[model samples]
Target: MADGQWWRDAVIYQVHPRSFADSNGDGVGDLNGVRSRLPHLRDLGVDAVWLSPFYVSPQADGGYDVADYRAVDPLFGTPADAEALIADAHALGLRVLVDLVPNHSSDRHDWFRRAPAGGPGSPARDRYHFRPGRGARGELPPNDWHSLFGGPAWTRAADPDGSPGDWYLHLFAPEQPDFNWANPEVAEEFRAILRFWPVRGVDGFRVDVAHGLVKAEGLPDHGRSARLLDLTSTPFWDQDGVHEVYRDWRRLLDSYPGERIGVAEAWGRTPVRTANYVRPDELHQAFNFHHLTCSWEPAALRAVVDDSLAAMRAVGAPATWLLSNHDVVRHATRLAPGADRARAATLLMLALPGSAYLYQGEELGLPEVVDLPDASRRDPAFRRTGGRDGHRDGCRVPLPWHGDRPPYGFGPAGGPSRLPQPDDWAELSAAAQDGVPGSTLELYRAALAPRRAHPALGGGDDLVWLPGDDAVLAFERGAGDEVLRCAANAGGHPVEVEVGPAGELLLSSAPVDHDGAHVVLPPDTAIWWIPARAPRAAPASAPAPASTPMAAQTPTRSSTSALGPPPP
Candidate 1:
């Protein structure tokens, strides 16, 4: 609503740094690689760029186990490289957001390393959750908790004298020991960590495990955890104490220049619980995972959208939408029917009111590499969960920038990507689609450029659902002269729907048959159309926005306006 609140409507691109781009022939993406690619983001028209963990880490859990929050991992680059990347991004009119891992640290971290040496009742041990075993000989784990990566959350460590001293809590891998947020020193240390990045011009943080940090008091025994979209299944997540930590971060962000913000990577028990992280006095926004988890059915999509919007609106926060990320199967494959369905979903997500997040390589229509050999797999979930949802490595495959061979220009000819690219990635390379009409890359560019500048799009809450069949979702956003119609055919076979008066066929996820009033949308296709007619007048008792003529046209569409809906 104000100049400083750019996050409310930002389109942020998530960069999995190690897989995004590689420079210096190292077969690894570094901060300088990100800097070199700033122009691509500028051209793509995203408002901001978010980097996943690149801090000093052991590559355990893919950088989530942080050893040093302030230093850059040599695998990525130096601190100077990070600053240069931030500066370059800003120069290219992009804001920079870094991932923050405050819930836990690498077991190799100095503090965690010295924890055992300090012995029981020591300040170092106090920083983390270290408890005595439950049995007489102290052989059993302290609690009934399970690690998110799979197995016992508690790992027993030897005492300074080499005896089994105490068991430490690690919600994820044993290398990632959870911090004791109950401790004042833990909060104070994070306070300084929060202050460290802004001075270097970080626009915001995408808080990792934002729903975590504060566990239920007394570390109560909880049953086996279910890995689901709802993170609050157990006492460890969505606790009331988590909000206080975010509120403190909000205050710290507000005091900083550049409108610094924090966006939660939180998955709550419900949309309402998720909204708590984005309250006016808390963080700027929380990711709405429904877009990724919701089914492709029309009713399901609309329901999740309404639920997400209502929840965020209650807190005066803008909703966030996403489809695929590094942690899940790429939507290109998950949504199936290949690129068309994925493209259709993209339009639907963009037409909705909120900030949108795009994962790296999504525009290139990359599908999940599901067949990676077992020996090449790196996701710990492979072993931890007995291969349940362990395909994260599939989505983390390095992006192919150009060229037509293996690696597809990801690195030097002899240098290989950390993860293998699919054989067909040659045509999917950005170079292959650079100027190809109807290419996924071009479609994204078309949608993003308009979504960025369209008067009624980007930031607003004025969306009205238009009547349509159960297979169709039709809605108009903005008001009066600035109105734009969006609809999706989330069904099999074609369905024709009347969308009031004639509108310009501005964009379509796929070719569709439509006139001014009626459109026949194919299964898994969507459209962004606008009516050309006299503007609605405001009530005599109220002020009205000045009517502006709608003349902007950008997306490439085959106008079947004269053909009407195809026979079905």
Candidate 2:
């Protein structure tokens, strides 16, 4: 193993601040709420906490539309709360990583205010993409490209209509205009921002929508409007010149001494093309959201895994995997009702040979909240749904800390609570499932704890997939002296898998059937085994002593009847 390479096999827990916990009765989660929950996270055994944007913003795009990159949003908490989180997280031996949104800022940002007027010599003026207007309507200007959240890419500025003022470009929503990376000042300006946070003790950053940084020049008009669409922004996104920008940023981050992880949110087509962002100096890893986004099917999963592996091997690039994030519906709902396949997916995720990011509530197997009142919905996607299914607010619901709270363990309790407690948390709260033998949460702990202890599982290379019944995807991971085999059942029915003589079951999501030449696995489950006399296998390790058993607990919480649907 390499020094500080632990992140290569590490599992990152992504905490969405607004829904994590609310400290005061303001009905929003804050940093202090996060600090209060540190013990729960530490006990969960994550390598690091990847916090979503907490920067100052106008709240038009959640926190993505940053107004002041350096300051914390008062809604989230003060800078001291952030410092306290870092201090507490470090004390628990967990690393901290913050989100860095370099693509764009809110239209309300100070830079936009000064630019509309002829602030000719202003440095911030050129930071945004500004071009001469092109449209029939004096108020309405520019291209036919639609936003990712569903709307025209360009909006009328506050400036006088029919003026010669230039129009700004926003790929996602009109509220969030894209930045001009072509400007050397913008690139250097962000590099300076990168250097500023490490002083506050952030270990690294999760670069949000990184490939969206640069846009094609010439300002050509897109032909049609399409929701969740990409207009190519002039063909500059994911372009060749991006590599130089990454290289420059990497060099600047290297000055921090210890390794600084840079995992890019790269959303592109082919796995091979996405791998280009993960080369040695470009970016430590480019997130692999392919499998997570696809429909649940064995063949699909197999193809994605194979393609991803081939892509990385071909480019000699490191890889990172994410099953779900704030943007989409929760995996539990995707896999089965109430996220039934969460444990099985978790097993497969960790068994893979790369870094993995686990979204909050995934361990608890929480389902996505589909019903949100129009008055409460906040996401742009939900708004455009025409009062149909709510947007990401369902997946972004507040963390369930206790069982008695509303929404089956989500926001604040009773008539009123200090934070936005869930209505009925007893069903899915960590306290409710911690010791249950068959709980999804415990199974995750059982499986993940071993990865940290076993070098073969954590640091091996050269994984070989062994054929089994169509239901099972069997594979062995080994590099040099370390070797281990993982056999998993990806079907709804049990399947028999044959390994070798005298192999022992190290961990199982269900009872293993070790009879005859083949072992049987329960429906939608998996188990790992090691050779009895392998030369390079890491020594066997046990689950932490304090971990509780499943049988002793009763369902202490109520149903989803208590709390209302998630915030809009």
Candidate 3:
């Protein structure tokens, strides 16, 4: 990859500010907290850090409901603290990408606040999706669109006439009113917000809800499916006009000295539709949610991998692989049947032909804290849905840096964390795994070291799948002497396979036994091999064992044995 185009194959760490670290005793994480953790990221060997929203907010949706784009929230820190964090990350040779919520803003936002006080046809109301209701007395919403959290997407607006008046559209929580992108003033305001961050030395932005910015010309009812996942023909998402908005943002980003990028957090109906967001003239990259949502079944995973690679190649953009982020359950808990499977998945993801994103505590193999108290839940979806499937707070608990108790060194001594962290996280704390051999932290560090040092490992769109059983997925990256082979066994038992000319074993997610011509791969494992020679004859299958599959066992809290012994 070119020096300036560092993001193409880079490993970007997603840091949710409120959970990463808390420098202050206020029980909240701040930018200064992030600045202090720069060395941890540098040592962990990530190329960049993608911070979730820290902009001014009412904390309605974990900072996603932005009150101001330009200012840092007091809960996070001052604008100076943000600049210092950026400078510190750069000094550690890490790029900084901040989250930008363009789809909506907090109802407390200056524009949103002023818009409600005006009449239906006022200029202030035009800045948002403000329209009169369908019924004669304006009792019903303008349309039947539903909020992503739940309930009606449109909420009644208090009018200047002191009557139940026009309803404004909010695709998410009512506190987060969607912007009227059709308004010229809205587009220009965002362009200026785009310019504001780069001036502070931020490398780029991870554009929140990028595909939901522009809606259909008419605020029509979403006739059939109101599900958020069905974005293909949706009136509110992935509209054609969204591309023009991105094209404009692209121009502003490219104007900067560095190859400043815009990564779309877009969800599309198909890989091709998702790829459209990253066309040459538009955004630089988009999160591959297809790969993230794929199951552990070999056929499903292979399909997603193949489709993702082909789709991204079609757009001349590198595929971005992410296992977990702030909104979903951590991959360690959601994807794998056990810790071993999670480790294998990580190895498989890192070896893929694209950029990779790592969630904050994922390096330490943190599992989702699924049982946070109802009172401690802060996600808007949970409250809006009356505690249904909106359990995102489980994945946003504070990180355990050190110590053996609550807060786990996340904040000041004896001070509680903003969200309840599981007591079992003591074993997964960074301090506990820092130098331990065979630990998840070590495996990640070891894996990333070579990924950065090896030319064939990073930044390439070349992958040739090797013939193997349905349970095993093997592929070679690059070609000739610069080649590296990666294989994963997503099965119930060990499988022996011929890895063309038996190269040197660089790393393995689990222990492997090689017998010159055939390599025995354990179930729920993956490996990276550096090629040493040409193709070899295939090996015969070994007899199946009578024991139960390894998937039956629940992984222990601190199970580094799942990763096997340290690399020789």
Candidate 4:
């Protein structure tokens, strides 16, 4: 890939800062912790790391409720630490993309704090959507729109006169007041925020709620059953005006050097609508939630892949594939029954055309901590619904870096993690799997090495479906001598398939036995085959030594919540 288009085929690792590594014995991951781990990512063979939100916030919704975009929260570290971490990552040939929460701001933000002190119609109020409530005594909410977490979207404000106050819009928790994008000051402020971090040396941003900056012109009632995943034509999401905001931001990003980019966490009803966010003049990429939501069934996975590739191709953008992120149950637990299936799924994801996103801890085969106590649940979604729906905290537990006990070196000894780690995680800890042949960690290392070195592995937007049984998915990427083929068996039983003259075994998610003319694919396994003439060499960067000690400590008490939406 060219300098400006590295993201096109890059393998980007998502680092949930709080759960990654804790420095200073605070039990919370910080910038210095990330800096210390730069060699880990460099050795993993990924081109970049996408850090989750670590901005100054009230922690009501993790760091997504930004109190100050330009400042780093004390729980994570200081501004100087952020700059040093970015520089260190770049030094390791890894780009850094920090999370940007543009949809809303913490209620504790200066603007939000001062707005309530002003009367209902004051300019301060205009910066956000503060309107009078409906009904004779202003008892009713302004509209029927619901918060993504739960309950009414509008929350009553404190009036300057000490009377029943006007309502403010918050698509998420009440602690996060939605910005009035229609207001010029709102746009100008965000534009300033966009420039602030890049000037500090961030390579780009992963825009949270990228489809939600603009609401419908009238803030009309949605008038339907409100659910977090029900985003179809909602008044508060995916509005046409959001594109204008991105176009302006894109211009500002292009003005910077080092090919700075913007990635969108956009959820649209269709692939075409999702592609709109990545138009050449707008953001650089958008997550393919369609693929993430796909079932393990061969037909479903095939369709999602086909549609995603086509939609991205139409807009001349790369299709970014991901299996599990922080908000969802880990794929090892959610996609199928075990680790083998998750490995196969990942292999399939990595072999496809375009970029891939690997969530932190996934390489270690960590499953979701599903048994977290009710008292330990911290997601606002869970609190809002009284634990009926959201349990995202299960996936946000601190990672087990080493040792064979709880916290597993996740933090300094004697300190407890913010979220509990299961005792069984010892088997899945990085320390246990590191350098173990055929381990999931090694599988990822092996896969990523070739992805970076073999030209046929990561680049290309074309895929040709090869004939296979109903339970099998087969496709070839690239053309001529560079062609690479991938076949995945989703069935529960082994399936023998013909190996054409072009087939040369390159990598497999599971053990595969081959005869003179056929290859036997194991159940829930995927394999990558390339032309025999394809070049093979060690990856440019070597893997980190097994004994390289990472800072493992417990999490400190902080109010941070989960960073993004609950997975669908």
Candidate 5:
């Protein structure tokens, strides 16, 4: 979107603001905290930083329920702080992406607060889905749609005369009332919001609930009391009208300078349907939840990767791959008892030809805080589901920056952290692994180095999968000296992968033994090997240095994985 396809291959870091860092000893991450940490992202070699929601909110859904699109929440910071942070990020050569929640708004939002008071048929109430109940006394909900977070999607509202009134639609929590996209005012308001940030140097937006903006013609039943955690389409999600909303947004983004873009958080049931959100006339990209939810098996991983690329390519869009995010279990714990498999998965995601997303603390090899005390949990979904679903708090704990105690260097000592920290994280702090050999932090840094320096890993390459067993995946990119070959062993036993006879090993997720033609890859290990570069020929006008030897043609592959992790 930025004149060329810079985002197509970018390594963008997702910063869960509340858990990223606490500035002013406030126990919550604000814009200034992120600004202070901009250098860490720059030094980490990522091209952009995608910040989670910090807009004015009641924290009912962790800032996803916006009370005001143009204002920053007082709990986080001021508008000035956000502007300064954007300026600071650009100064550090990093682009910034802010979250935009378009599907719903906090019930406290101005328009929503006035909806019930405006009565059922009033224009003010028309902005949102305020409809009459279905029963004889208007006591039943309009439809049986359930909230994505849990419970019924419909919530009864009070009338202007203080009598029982209409029911409003909320796909998430009751505090978040879904807007009526069919209302012209709804689309017009978002158009203004789409223009608000890009003019202030904000690079793009990560649109939340992109596909759920429009529901089916009538408030039809979804056939479930609570929607299961699957990407299946329903009457309330991924409807056809959602694409029309994005096409309008895409047009607005194109009108601005600096390649402003929009990334959809759409959950289409199939890859082809998902691709529709990223067509040239729609939004620029969409998150690939398929990869995030993929298992630790080679066949499943290959299927997702192949399907993602094929579908995205068909629509002339770049595929996005990621292993971790704030809402899911961290791969470290998901692929545990050791970090080997998670580390390998990170390498595999980076090796694939597309944009990559890195969740906060992932490079430090942090596992999800699966044992957080129930009293400290703040996820609304967890609260509403009666504790049966929604375990996202485990992945949103404050990051350990340095100290060896709870709140582990996340901020000043004694700061009131919004979420508790794990004391054990001190050993896994970014400070502990900054330059440590073979550490996950170092592995990420090393992987990013070549990706930034090599053309083969750039935006234009295609992945060519090689023949391998069910437990392994092999692929190559580029041609001749620039060719980069990669293979991963995702099984329980060590494997000998035939990667080609004339390449140099650049890096691997785990230690290995290789003889050019074959690499004895350990379980859960992935490697990056490139065709060995040939020696430079002497200029026609000058002879080569006498010290230069003929044997240089067969230089050994350069690598740092030889002393890394071994098969466990």
Candidate 6:
């Protein structure tokens, strides 16, 4: 609500450091590359850049497996380079947020090495989730809750003294053992870790797997263990006391005035459960992933949006929205008719209230790369799940930088790269789209700029779907003079409707023609209306055919809306 609260209506761009750009001819992206690209991000007009984990990591889990919470990973850049990038980003009027993986660390970390196999008397033994009689030689840990990456979550290891004695729980990978948040030492360590970046001017953290920070008291075998032998417990996630941990971090974050923000990645839980992690003293916002997982039906979209909002309001916390991320199939492929559908979805995402996160390449309307080699896979989920879907590597592919050379859109190499570069840079390069009107990139900028400019559009009341042609998804944002009506055609066919005498188009994804109370919306388009100052004359054309309701209209709203449905 305050000007200082920039994050309330901010658009966050997620960058996977290794794939963003490469400055020194190495295949992977580096700090210098990202620093060099600050102007592009600034031009794009995003409020903040949410850089994925760059802390010293083993590259297991794509940097989620932290070895040093404060140092920069060599693959990314030096600590000094990171500081410079932060300064550059700030100078460009962009806020920088780093990924914090307090949940675990690389097993190769000094602490992990001290514990080795969770052996007795190891200083790091208690740093992770360890259970008795679960060593590599002993029977596996007794739970069946599958890892997010697939397979069992338990991994056997030797003690620091080379003694064989224990097993540790890894919700995602063996390298990322679950941190024992129950331990005061661990909590303090994380607090210190958080302060490290903020001291260097990092705005905040996008906390990794926030809900999975703690586990259940007893390591009981989750009933599904027979099928998932590697897991230790089902109740291990979203356990009690997580809020206490987050509340502690919230306090730490408050030490800095303004700029500080926190968003939690709370997958696998209802918005209610997710909201619990975002209370006043907890996370500033928790991700609402319902839209990403839902089908392209109006009813489905409306229900999820309503539910997610209600959940957030009930908990007195803010919500964040996302359509695609490194872990899921690109929204383009996830929707019907692919990119066109994704464009419509993006319009809805921006029009709704809350903080929005745009994944790199999403604005380019890039489709998921279905063709990927098994050897080139980056997501362990596919490996553990027998490849039900290809690994996330396809979605995490390199971004083309206006050149049709090596490394596709990434890296400094000149020829034949890891992923073949696309033939046309014009279609995807930031430079190519910056000045082109109606380009996906431009549209994204337009979509977000309005929200940033108008507070009424970023935070508001419940989005109530106006009853009319079910083909169009329409709702009112805010109240009184600030109330803006946003309507979009979620279907492939065109929609024409009455806009009430006072309505005037504020924004639209599709072409709009209005006369008096009647408004015509082209196929797959949108129109935003503000309460008109006075009544207008009527149009000459007749309204479109009112097809019998095949289904209910969908009124999707952001989770942060003061009023809305609860997330399912």
| Model 2 worst lDDT window (10 residues) | 559-568
Q: What is the RMSD of candidate 1? A: 6.9
Local distance difference test values of all predictions, in order: 0.81, 0.69, 0.83, 0.82, 0.81, 0.70
Clash count for candidate 6 is: 19
Tens-digit lDDT string for candidate 2 (1-568): 3545656777788998887777775667789878888766666667789999999988877798888899999998899999999888878767889999989887777777667774433455678876545655444565555566765666655444435555677877677888888888778778989999898999888999887787656656556554332424335356666777788888877788557778788766678768878777777778887877765567888788888878877666655667778887888787773243556676777888777888988878777777655566678655755645337777887767665555333344442322233444567878778666667676666666656656666553357878667777778886545567786677778787764565555666655556534567776666676765666333233332223221111111221111211111
Candidate 5 vs candidate 6, lDDT winner: 5
RMSD in Å for all candidates: 6.9, 6.2, 5.7, 7.0, 6.3, 7.0
The TM-score of predicted model 5 comes to 0.92
Model 1 C-alpha lDDT per residue in residues 471-537, reported as the tens digit of each score: 8888888875777778888888899866556455556787666555667788888887666662542
**lDDT order of candidates, best first?**
3, 4, 1, 5, 6, 2
lDDT value for candidate 3?
0.83
Of the candidates numbered 4 and 6, which has the greater lDDT value?
4
> What are the models' TM-scores?
0.93, 0.88, 0.93, 0.93, 0.92, 0.87
For candidate 1, the lDDT comes to 0.81
lDDT tens readout by residue for model 5, 7-107: 88888899988888888897987777887787777767788889999988999988998999999898778999999998888887778899999899999
Tell me the tens digit of each residue's lDDT in model 3 across 1-568.
5767777889999999998899997888888998888888887878899999998899899999999999999999998999999988887788899999999999999998899687888899898999888877879989989898988899998888787888999999999999998889999999999989999999899999988998888888887647667775689988888999999999999899979999999998888999999999999899999999988889999999999999999989999898999989999999767788889999899999889999999989999988788999988878888998588888889999999997888998799789988878899999998766557887787677656656677677888888878899898887665777888998888988775454555566765676545578888898777666733211111111213222221222233222322121
List the candidate 3 regions with Cα displacement exceeding 4 Å: 500-502, 534-568
| Higher-ranked by TM-score: 4 or 5 | 4
Query: Candidate 2: lDDT of 259?
Result: 73
Clashing pairs for predicted structure model 1, backbone only: 502-516
Better of 4 and 6 by TM-score: 4
Highest-lDDT candidate: 3
